[model samples]
Target: MMGTSGGSEEIIILSDDEDDKDTSCLIVEVEAVKKTVGVLPVSPQDEDLVVTFSRRPDVLPHARYDCPIHPFMPTDCERTAPMANNELICDQCFCYICDKLASLCGMWCCSGACHCNSHNKSDFWNDVRNTALLGELQRFNLTLSEVDHHLRNADTMLQSFRDELSALFSSIPLDQAMLPDYNINQQDLSSRYGPVLECVTLFLNKADKKNSRAAAIMHLGAAEEFMRHFQVLGFMGSSSAATTSETIIMLLHRVISSVQRRIVMGDITPLFMQKLQTFYQNRICFPADMRPLKNRFKCFIFGRNLSPVFCSLTIRPWQDVLLVSVLKGQNVSGFRKDKGKKDILFETISVVLLRTELLQLQSRYRELCRYLRVVLTDNTTLYQHLQDLIPFFKCKLGEFGSALESLFPPASPPASRFTPPIFLLYLRIFETATAPRLTVSQPEQLCFSGASWEPIKDAVPLKRSELVKFALKAQRCSLPVGSDPQCWASLLKVVCSPHGSPTALPVPSQQFLHESRDAVIDLLNQQGYNIQISRCFLKTYPDQALLLLVTGALGVRILQGSFSPALPVLHAYKDNLWAFQWLCEGMTSSEDRLKSFLKEITQESSNT
Candidate 1:
């Protein structure tokens, strides 16, 4: 008996002398085969490669070495005995039974069986092939179904969002004028139409979670579709046009409210907020004409506390035009040609007021401070007036102290001084006792910055009878008794000779002479002046028709010697009628004092 020890196992071979010799030779051959097929020790760096199993081991089917099975097989073939280890296979061998590379087939060089040349009809090999093929088909089917399910879900969500959007649009009026009140309740809207907002939010959140480009594209498409629908409804018109659609405005309110809520709750990231802001600026608020209105709306929504940041994002610099117009109760048509923009302005103000009423005391204080800052920066003339007006709100001074400090901190640089029309308009709206004194030489710098010929351009031709009436009204109202009979006579001859009886005067000549006397009278009445004052200013300043039309007076003392005082006021205000009108409407001083002030300012400007 001979024994051999391999690791922990001991093999004992009992044989006759001749048999023992053959067994020893067989053991030597087995040891040589094991040495030839042994696996190399894996290095630490190659540990990952150890787990990488090849599923497609038959990828290279061509022979790697010369063999009898190939085209160069010799007629007389020498065949070597199969090895006793499954891992040992000739490079050129292939398993016919497994339909794979012989090197990858474990049974190809098995100790008791070699399947490299096994017949295709073998039952054992057929079962192995069939099991693998069935498993692959099953996996492919599951993968395809998963893709289909995801596609269907996406379609369903998109359709649901579309339907919800349609419902929300249907609830709001297309025209703002149709609404009973301009104010919209954000909470009420969220309660009633929250699903629409939630649906959009859900899509955005899912896209973010999945990091999916397709999902992101889908969200963008939906947003575009919503905007397209708005345009189709005439709510988002061209740059030169305007829309009063309550639907779009309310939609904006809801969207902004939702986004703000999400941001506050930590449901969205700053990156997402930035993207949304960009989308709003580029897509919703890009039009040059609509910029003023939309910026005002955004400014109101963000409130005064965030004004600094919001102001930077605004498409244009902030202006108080809308607020001034609204406070003055001026007709929307007087401010802008677009009716839609007018409605939006009113609506935005209405919403701001409504929200103010509902806010907590601190919030209201912040809002007050914001308004104070706006007045201080844009309409410095009204800042003190607002301080006076603040008392009427019944807010305690102590409560606003903190907010005021934050807005105008100690030793902070003073706000840039400006004299916007709002300054004068606010004074008029509040009916202040006197205009604020200006430290700057020309507080009305913006007023005289450019020339305007609108008075001449807008004049209408009038009949001879109308001219006679205008002349009579002017003579009765403004002419001093027995002072200028020759002046009246000359004016009448000049007025009557231009056009015969019942003849129409040329528009340009009549503009200089009359300039729509009736309309001027109406405008004067609108500005709280009586018919006598209107007719007197019109008749006395027939040569300064542009001045009369703009300032509602000759902008000078009536019956004052020399037109020098009037000349300065006219020169400073002729082109900027809008600002001049605001100043005139707001002034509580007598005509002479206003004229003196204009002369002083003009002198200061010249000296500077």
Candidate 2:
């Protein structure tokens, strides 16, 4: 201890006497000068490092003993940056540690360990980072080139069973292939792969930006292949990469984001074709009959937040194929659903938004009652926004429920179930590479994150004004929009058509939607009523019929504690249980297609 002795201290005086010499000799360490001590002696086989000092009793006494160091002789005063501020506990990315790359936050990723004694900046270590970063860049480029090439030249990339999934995930070597598994411990890794993981972490961390958007697209293709290979070969033997939840999340995000970006670009890449091939094969994402895998929540959260771009893409034909993935209770994605196996579906998105939007908004407030009162006080935008989403909300509900049935059919496994499967055939045709060959009847419906009618009346001939007036009047006066001469003709058609119960308008096929819409408008104008999907059933049928019919088909038994039932289920919420109301409505299909569709919907609702 650096302490001062209080009171009187005795001072020793040197004497020339022989007795004095003996005392002086006792004060000196005989072994200290004779022995050579090492800084740190480490054996290749053992991580344990031994730092030894000469066995000298005299020097040991004068060592001050605060810390057991040798006698003062310029003892090293080891220190690191003052323990980072209690409030400033930010951790640096491995890239910052290795390659000196900055985080999305424009600063070099740093941590207490950045300059730790255990691992510090040495020329050798510095060279290791620089060299590894170079290889990482090269690997990045190589995988990028492979994905881009495959996306362009289906001829070469999609040739065999092996050359698929180059879009969603990539196959970069650990160049210093230290940790073959993602779960390798930091100390266990080649001290090089840390930066690589950091680079990946940065990519996965970003939320809603363009740069991160494109990379995920390319990675998904490769991930698709990697996962498939994992399923077939069981090559890695339950290592973290093979079974971690985080890896799976990253894998799905990459594929989903890639498809979205490529589709938006209107460029059909080879990976797209490969995906089509895979779809037709009814191949499992992970091989069936493999050992069960556990879920990794952290990685899934990262992927979920990073996946806005992927989430926005309206999966027309693909949802039918992808939803078949019975979300293992262990492997659910971003959606915060408890029933993971059945919960994550496109329809489940509404549930997420409902929970998240409120939670996020609430986080910004101190008191719930004050905020609730504020919301109550303002009917302005809040009420209007809610009103606008009504039509869109209904569609989401239907789509979500429908997704559950389509995706998770009971008593059927993925691979063996699709024999002469028409559903598989449809997906393949949609995914086919050569050219756009779509049947008129097999029209692909385009779902929307937003709604039509109110939002999209600009496309209609009669101004948005006239349409709204009719809808409002229908609502207030209890008159079908079709009952008025201006609105009556259209109302009758929707009322007369067997399937015309309109709790939700159908997601119109892109090719046939405009024509159906035009048919609806014309029918309204000519016949004083209309048929087909519409904004409100008031123009066609009474409120009772529409509400009862739609709710019945939904088949969701409402749970007691729900925030909002009028919601859209993005892919994650497909299996959310709604407290459904059922009726004993007899839906017998007579002769008409409309009648048959309605009847089928009704019958299915009751039977289920």
The candidate scoring highest on lDDT is 1
lDDT of 2 by residue, 1-608 (tens): 02236643334445445464565533321232366677776668567656676674542211111113321111122222322221122233223223331223222223433222112234543443444433322222223334433233332222232332332223434332334555565454424333434434444333223232233333443444555544433433434343243444454555554544443333344454344334423322543322122111112232233332222223322223222222222223423344465332332232222322342233321121122221221223333333222222222222322222322233331211222222222222222211121111111221222313222111212222232233322322222211222222232223222333333333223433223333433333433212233545334333323323333222211111121112221111122112111212212122243344445546545665
Compared with the true structure, all predictions reach lDDT values of 0.38, 0.30
Q: Which ten residues in a row have the lowest lDDT in candidate 1?
A: 309-318
* Model 2 CA deviation exceeding 4 Å by range: 1-150, 153-184, 187-220, 224-248, 260-388, 391-608
Model 1 Cα lDDT, one tens digit per residue, 1-608: 35556643444444444565674533322232344677889788876565646574443354322333343222111123242232334555556545467678776545444453343354654444444333322211222222333334544565666677787767655653132333444454455445544555566566444323224323443554465555554534422112223333444444444333333323233444455446555554323334564545333221223221122222111134654453444533324545565323322222232223332234343344344333212333333434333322212223322312232223321111212242222222122112221111122421332423121122233333333333333333332411233323233332322332333222234343343545555644542111233445445334344323433323222333333323334334324344344445434356665566567657757775
Task: Give me the runs in candidate 1 sitting further than 4 Å from their true place.
Answer: 1-159, 163-224, 233-244, 285-288, 298-608
Clashes of 1: 0
- TM-score, cand. 2 vs. native: 0.21
